[model samples]
Target: MENFDEQFSITKTVEFIQKNKSTRVILQLPPKLLQFSSKIEKHLKKALKNDKISFFILAGASTRHCCVDTVSSARVFGDLIVHYGHSCLSSTAQIPILNIFIPTKISIQNIISAFETEFSTQKTKQMILFYSTEVENSISGLYLQLNKTFPNLKRTLLNLPKNEKEKVKKFEQKQEQEQEQEQEQEQEQEQEKEQEQEKEQEKEKAKEEEKEQEKEKEKEKEKEKEKEKENLKIFGRVLPITDITQLSKNQLIWLGSSTNPTLFSLALTFGAENFLVLDPEKEYLEFEKMERMQPMRRILMKRYALIEKAKKSENIGIVVGTTNPKKDLQIVKYLQLLIKNSKKKSQVISMGVVKSLKLGNFVHDLDLFVVIGCNESLILDQSDYYRPVLVPDELDLALNHDREWDGTINLNFYPNHDMIANLEKKLKQSFDLILIEQQNQKQIENLIISRSETRSFKGLETRLGENKVTKIEEGLSGRASQYQDEIDLN
Candidate 1:
């Protein structure tokens, strides 16, 4: 009755147990911690070594059935209750109750090292440490002493209440918030950097546009100067004739045909002793030898060689004929490959008949011929008592058609005389030439351009490469038309 609760304090409890020589110490513990309980019991017993202090190790079924009344009964029977590894719930006896919070297991050394690393690197100004009572008692004092040594580092030791589940939940919530805030800040910085890059790109684009505008203006001025120079030369020169040697050596003209004797003679007149006939057709090759003098034949053995030859030629031009338009076009293309290979120096001239000179029912004379050399040839096609003049107007009109569209006429099969005549008239009007040499310069240009566009064949033998042109049977029944259609679509 005289302040019995005062003795329940940890100091008094220890003192009272020591005084009683025959005190029965009952050690009650959780089943999970039975091993810890036995170790603690052995340690305590050794500390109070007098055999007068009786020890009863309650375990198994006895430990499972333990309650406050059972514990109180032990106290009434002159025993002191010492609960191990469990929080104290209630005490009914006036005898002292010692709640010894001995750890179930020791904290691993690795876990201590991990804690130290985490605490040192944490961005937060303050951090807290939490542990069970046993762990606190073992390490809290050491941690406090260390904190004093590093005064900048502060720590809070969470000495939780009997039930500390809620405190743990709150600590977890705070840690999650800190991590989320750090992540958001990092994301914001990345977005800002991306926006800055986009702004720099826009500035670069604006500068490029300004530079492009300046370049375009300079190109226009140069083009106008060239056009004026060309007009002045035309005014100074004599009229174009069958032979153009009278013109300046540097002056260039597009002769449209390799099959004409006049064109061949014109080449000789212009000091062109060498002939580079691009005629691939057997018929045109023979016709050139018979009609004109035996001129040197220039054949493209490989697409690459053609480029080199065209580049080296002094007066380069394309010569096309309407007699066999398709074959003529092939030659035109060969010349084009030469010109394109020659780089940009070679000029092209296309020549064709202005009208078909029909000789009765079976024979027709090819009045058109393109002479692409250094000069224009003087010879003209004769019909009985009249010599027909080759008109530039006709040539211009044909060239316009060739330039505008694929003038792929099969003159071997589908020679439309009226269409040819119309083309000639249009060219005559356009160029203001009364008797213009009929030529399709654009067709020859296209040939060169097409061959130039072809990719260079790698590791191919020279002779085999020359036959790169896809051949089809000479009739409409062949699949050449379909192949051409496919090419056009592409």
Candidate 2:
């Protein structure tokens, strides 16, 4: 609630409604900030007391700004959507979106001390102030004092341009989602039949299967709910930028931590030599830049190696990672078209979250799989599947032979018109060469599989259907402190 700017938000929302002649609006806040919806609505109603403006709160919580509530806005027929807390994505929505940036708890004194402590000894002039939602509170003070001392200090504000699309893809995606849900229900019903014991108790057996399927569905829903939770604990603290961008800017000092969506976007988008750590919590400011992001840099190498393997691939599977109605379907379509042009067989699979076990079933049919989703969530840990799972960016690099290695992966492929258009053109061009390559590669597929090690899951013969006892390293002592206050001797 500390980050909620009630006065400012209410005023702005009222003004916007009046100017646009809007009667209804939907409020979309991050899960962390959702509790303040009632208070915000109250203030809004009081302000527009005379007018009959209806305000609806979006029940579906979002993790990142990329998860725009297109469904709510469209379904409600809302004139505008007031998105709060997170920084904006470079996405054009069907409805007008008002992004309200609320400042974190970091004070001006803390920010000033961070700057002074970092540059007390040395003369560091070329420094950039990178900030997100925490702008209104800390920025004015930093600017007031710093500008007087230094002449040219640059600030990179991560604000998105307002570009509303004429056609909204929400309705179309919703239809596809409904059809998929129906298909899933049918498949689950079929699986229940195999799991049942006898036909004598058919109705009872069907009920049991329904209960089992419901339990599985409940688990999946819980997993998705956990995924949407924001790490609100990471906010307000300043953190170092680990990326090495090609931007000519000298030093980058980001104001927000990794929790802020803009921090990652700017770090990946901009090119700087070294990022100075000027966190408010630290007593001494880190003047020296941290070590280069070697792990991330290695992703480039992985991309190159994967591309080589994909070149000799005979079949491809397109895996859509997200079940959300607002996910991009164009990327899947384009990948299918690309593989088709190469004369390779391709299949599209909608897997909510890519699991190695689920994908292993298609290992024989598919030689390679391309995952379409968020860059962070696209690739899974260890990647234990038989076929290589690559994101859209990785797949794009692997398939297209005519593009320079930029060494940057866009998390959300938006607002990059040039890249998207060129990729389409390259994929649609004459495919005689690619088709020939695939034909030749088909001969080597069997040889590659024969050399690969087959993976297996085995049950312990001694303890079948038994719960194995877990080793407690600390035992009672560790748990005592955890529940000391709750336990009473009486």
Compared with the true structure, what per-residue lDDT tens digits does model 2 show for residues 216-319?
86997788565435211112222223233323545666665534444544444342234554444345434334225224446456756776788789899988
Candidate 2: residue 22 lDDT (0-100)? 62
Ten residues in sequence with the least summed lDDT for candidate 1: 405-414
CA RMSD of all predictions: 47.5, 28.4
Per-residue lDDT of 247 in model 2: 31
CA lDDT of each prediction against the hidden true structure: 0.39, 0.60
TM-score for each of the candidates = 0.23, 0.56
Cα lDDT of model 1 by residue, 318-390, tens digit = 3332232443454454434323332333333343322233212112232223232111222233343121222
